[model samples]
Target: MSLPLPRDLARALAFFLAPLLLAPLALAQQSGAASPPPPAQGATKPLPVFEIPQSGVEFQTGDTWGQNGQTFRLYGIQSCIRGTTFTNPAGAKLDCGEASIAYLAALIRDTKPRCTAVAQTASPPLIYTVCAAHVGANTLDLGTVMVTQGFAFAATDANGKPVNLQYAVAEGEAQKAKRGLWIARDLPHPTAILNKALRDAERAQ
Candidate 1:
């Protein structure tokens, strides 16, 4: 009932995820850690950390964005790939990837989360981060919210090993609850599509 991931994406995931696999930050974690200790008395004050606003920010997928001329994705979240389709209740096909993008856009617009750089990939430059947003006086992980609500999924390698076990847990719960994208019984998982593409590519080798 499950499919594998492609090698390229798997490797990309590793760079963004290896650190998380070893140590996951506690819930409500923010970019405060990036802030240096206050300057000594009378010393020049350090500049406050800058924040990026979600307004007009472009989304590459449900979990990725184009930032600073590079790719920025949530550390352990994978959105559906673009161009995939699923049928709606009205018997019309809808773009699953676009649906994911829309959901993420809504979440960003409503939550205004703040993210800190957690990892990066060489060459192409993919910045990975963990973001938290305030909801009802409680700060929550953005990736957790997306996966738990079924708008995104836990990032995994080609063999299906998850980056963060907790994200896998969230995804499982969402699936069980049939939330968001899970509501479509015939939903086409992005990883499955990638796996098939990989297999086909390998066969042609």
Candidate 2:
């Protein structure tokens, strides 16, 4: 003879057994291991276009290429800010910023440049990236080229460390040749100019 279960005990037993009883049914309904949903029907993928959007900048498709694009800042290079001028070797005031922009545009003409993001900046929403700009069968590091040609300066990281040692070396070479901004004897570094600007803005506030 078996004893009958109490009303509360019977309810508790049902609750515990419900999931165990339904689990096999759920498994049987599934064909195999679960799989990701397929891509939407008739959805066309966006192709990457390699074009300079602005001075000293380029962008390409990111991991989510079709959904969102990524902008890349040429790593380890700083072009002069607009309206800034420096005396050249010929003692003429030159707009270094504009020259840097033009040089970068010419260097990347008609080539598909691909970049790898190495770091990110928050204030300006920029990604620091190293890019290989291809010209025919030759490839060039855009940042290194800019520094070596004296069109830009070797930039520093957020922590104040040099962004790239190679870029520093290239900058030294450019300086030795008295190329670009290095022609001036007492001209301040671009970074110093930028820092002074920031300090002035803060003092005004």
Candidate 3:
């Protein structure tokens, strides 16, 4: 049997179909609202920097020499003696080695501040004793800063065992030297310093 369609029913169906066709537009608007915007490209934060004392030593990025603003290392210059070692605070031993103070000092004086450096050592009671000026520029980097200081040690025999020997280390250059420093004991020579200390100790006893 054939049935007749109602006019109201046809109008309601058209209205519902019109909204269904526009559902994609509604979904697009909802998606835009739900997502966050992308961050700006090439944006970056700056690095932080801190200041240190002007007189303080500035070490290289990977340097192990400096601690609490002071830096130090072992230096070697030509010496006349043999078979001696100085123990560091860390319990490591350095053979005093040997070098000429006159030669080492001259080298330091002639060398350019940032271009050249003589290796040497400086510890308390004998600070910066290896170099002439007690300060030098780093050869590896011109911008890096360094200072040398002299120290005196009571000279002993080939072993670290102390004797009545007093020695003065002349200032030399930047960097650590295997020869230690050219040392003067009592007079301008290494022998005098060792002899003086031994004589003095004997007299005291």
Candidate 4:
């Protein structure tokens, strides 16, 4: 019954109504009534959550563990290797490596230990981490404890310098107390022992 709108008039009306048509959608978004779209395919994945075992942990060495098919090495500490023997101040033969592992295991017993990755090595696929073990009201830094207890040495860089000064201090304290490896009259540094072992292996090869 109404006459057809003029073409120019019809176009003008549509232009004016465009924003009005979209107003509800805008309001819905602003009011949190609409959800965001899912991420696009091939998006980067989120990082995995860190987890620790409920039961106490056991170490393959004072500073390393193999879990879930991955090798983890403790940061800022190094321990003697199995078959590495030294003499105690009491003139007794001591298997330093075994003793280190035993000491670490004892610390982990009945304690919930958790570790966060701090570094990684590619040559041997090792993850270096700082781990904390809860004991009563105190939280123990496992790596620092190892050095302080003289079961392990402060780790060193390729230039044979201490990796961390805090660990160095811990080692110094252990030395002063004449604990574990430090009890030896002629204490052999772990780095020197490791280097010598490497050289010997190369010569044998």
Residue 81 in model 4: lDDT: 63
Score candidate 4 by TM-score against the native: 0.66
lDDT of 1 by residue, 1-205 (tens): 3345455355433343443432333222333465333322343423222244666578877888765555567776778766777777777888887888899888878888887665444534455667787788999998999999998888765677776778999999999998988888788787666556656556766
Give the candidate number with the greatest TM-score: 1
- lDDT, candidate 2, 1-205, per-residue tens: 4344444233322222222322333233333545322212342332223444334343121100111344345645666554556777678887655667667666665555666544343332334446687767999887777788787776653334455567788988999998866777755465566544444545666
Q: Which stretches of candidate 3 lie over 4 Å from their true place?
A: 1-105, 113-188
> Stretches of candidate 4 above 4 Å error?
1-58, 89-91, 186-188, 197-205
Off by over 4 Å in 2: 1-71, 89-91, 110-112, 121-123, 157-160, 184-188, 199-205
Clashes of each: 0, 0, 39, 0
Better of 3 and 4 by lDDT: 4
- Summarize candidate 4's per-residue lDDT along 22-135 as a digit string, tens digits: 333333433586552221234333212254564444466666766676666666677766555788766888777677788877766656577766434343455556778787
In lDDT terms, how accurate is model 3?
0.27
Q: TM-scores for all candidates? A: 0.74, 0.57, 0.20, 0.66
Q: Which candidate gets the maximum lDDT versus the true structure?
A: 1
Q: In model 4, what is the error at residue 137, expressed in angstroms? A: 0.8
